[model samples]
Structures are given as structure tokens and as C-alpha cells.
Target: MKIYSFRKEEGKKITKYDSNFIMSRIIQSEKPVHVGCMHLEKNGVIGYHQAVVPQLLLIMNGEGLVRGERDEYIKVQSGDAVFWEKDEWHETKTDLGLTAIVIESEELNPDSFMALRIN
Candidate 1:
């Protein structure tokens, strides 16, 4: 069993992300799950990118705007959860600053499922 605290991890600037954006890794496992926390200062943005794997973003505090391939953006706030499928293009920006937990899995395989027999 393992426990991780976001406060313990030091934030690192992600070169690919816009200025004032930083991330701290929380957990990385061979089980396909990778977890991290991201902080975006006011007016910060995460440039458009595509998810190589499935991803889930959980809003921890503040508010932000998320945009997919579409031109429109969706406003999200604390307690909101967002999902992005593999290869889906997305981006995020915050005017009020935002903190969120990111969870992703690259090992998701639809072919590995086994049908269960039911009586």
C-alpha cells in the first residue's frame, strides 16, 4: 500500500505548458495508472495537445476553461471531473487560477476484456 501527499511533491515547470503553470507528480505505477497535480496561475494556459492515453482531470480548486477539438470552451470549477479519450485534443486555461488532479492510463486495452457467462 502506498500513500502520497501533494504537498510533499515539489512543483516543476512543464516546458510545454504556458507560463505560470506547474505540475507535481503524485504517483506513477506499472499498473498503468499515473497521477499528478497541476497548478495554473491566473491567466495560465495549457496549450492544445492530444492525450496519448485516456485521462481524467479532477478539479481541486478555482475555475478554468477546458476546450476539446471544438472551438468552444467549457467552464469548469471545483468538484468537476473531466475525461479525455486517447488521442483526443484538448487544452485548459484559467483566469482565476486553478488546481487539479490528473490521472491517466496508457495501458488501457479494450481487447483484454473477457465476457462473463450469466445464468
Candidate 2:
């Protein structure tokens, strides 16, 4: 068993990100799942990118805009959750700043379980 506290963890500034952002890795294991928290300052942006694995972003505070491969963008606020499939291009930005928790995994194959269980 493991316990993690965002408040206790030190945030590392992501220098590679196109925009100003800080991230705190909460849980990283060989189990295939990774969890972290991202903080974006006002008017900050996380430039276009794609995840190698499936990802879930849960908005924790403030509001922001999310854009996918399409030209359209969606507004997201606290409590909102977003999912992105592997290699799906996406980006995020905010005028009022934002904080979110992110969960990602490469081993999210539901088909493997379905194959084992005859349903």
C-alpha cells in the first residue's frame, strides 16, 4: 500500500512544455498506471501534443479550454473530467489558471479481460 499527498509532493516545472506548467508526480509504478497533478498559471497553455497511452484529466480547480484535433475547443472547470485515447492530439489553456489531476496507462486493454471471461 502507498499513500501520496499532492500538498506534500514537490512540483517540478516541465521545461519541455511549450507553456508554463508545473507537475507533481503522485504515483509512478511498474504496474503501468501513472498519476500526477498539473498546474497552469493564468493565461498559460500546454501546447499541442499526444499521449503515448490513454489518459484521463480531472479538473480540480479553476477553468480552462481544451482543444482536440478539431478546430473547436471545450471549456472545462472544476470537477470536469476529460479522456484522451492514445496518440490523440490535444492541447489545453486557461485565462484564469487551472489545476488538474492526470491518470495515464498503457495497459488499459479491456479486450484481454473479455477474452478470459466468457460473457
Candidate 3:
């Protein structure tokens, strides 16, 4: 699993036509993709499983702990994105709650768009 950032602080500032906004590019894929919003209540869990395709989970609200093949959980919150390669083992659970946008596809290349999370 890899952690990335989509926080406004890491986005490119848009100054076109006197517009004021920061655009955090998420993904650009020629291949098909699946996008969905996930809501997990307090102490909710998404059981461990192999990703059928590459997956990107963008934390939009709340926080959680995520684990990959190594079984080490990492804390993640809003604006944080987690990428898991196809067929990689992974799991996600939250002690409080979490709301995220999940994008999945066989051609995901998050590294090409988003930056790795900076400690």
C-alpha cells in the first residue's frame, strides 16, 4: 500500500481568468474506472481482501487505520489518499468514522498525478 496526498496545500493554484481555487488532480486514466463514496460508522471495518484491481481511496471525512500486506496499520484522515496495487491484500477500519471516495481500475497510476504523502 502507498499513501498519497490530495490536500489543498499540495495542489496547484489556479489563476486562470482571475479565478481563485486550488485544484488537486486526482487521476487521469484512459482505461475504465469505478468511483464510489464509502461511509463507515464508528468502529466500522472493511474486511481484508485482495483488490481485484488497483484501488485508490481518498479520505474525504473522518479518520481510520489502514493496513496492507505488511499488516501494519497507518492512520489516515481527510485529504489523504491510499493506493493499493491490484491483488494486494488490504484492510481498513475506523475507531470513530470515515467517509471516502473509492476509485478502482486496472490502469490506476496514482504516482503520475498525486504526490506521496510528506511526513
TM per candidate: 0.64, 0.64, 0.95
For lDDT, the strongest prediction is 3
**Cα displacement (Å) at residue 73, model 2:** 0.5
lDDT of 2 by residue, 89-115 (tens): 988899999999888897543322111
* Model 3 pairs whose backbones collide: none
lDDT of 1: 0.67
C-alpha lDDT values of all predictions = 0.67, 0.66, 0.94
Kindly list the per-residue Cα lDDT of model 1 for residues 1-119, writing each as its tens digit.
Answer: 01122331244667774566656443344666877999999998989999988776766899898877888787877655566678889999999999998888975322222111110
State how far residue 1 of model 1 sits from its true place (Å).
32
Query: lDDT of model 1 at residue 72?
Result: 78
- The 10 consecutive residues of candidate 2 with the worst lDDT sum are 110-119
RMSD of each: 13.3, 13.0, 1.4
Q: Number of clashes in every candidate structure?
A: 0, 0, 0
Worst 10 residues of 1 by lDDT: 110-119
The TM-score that candidate 3 achieves is 0.95
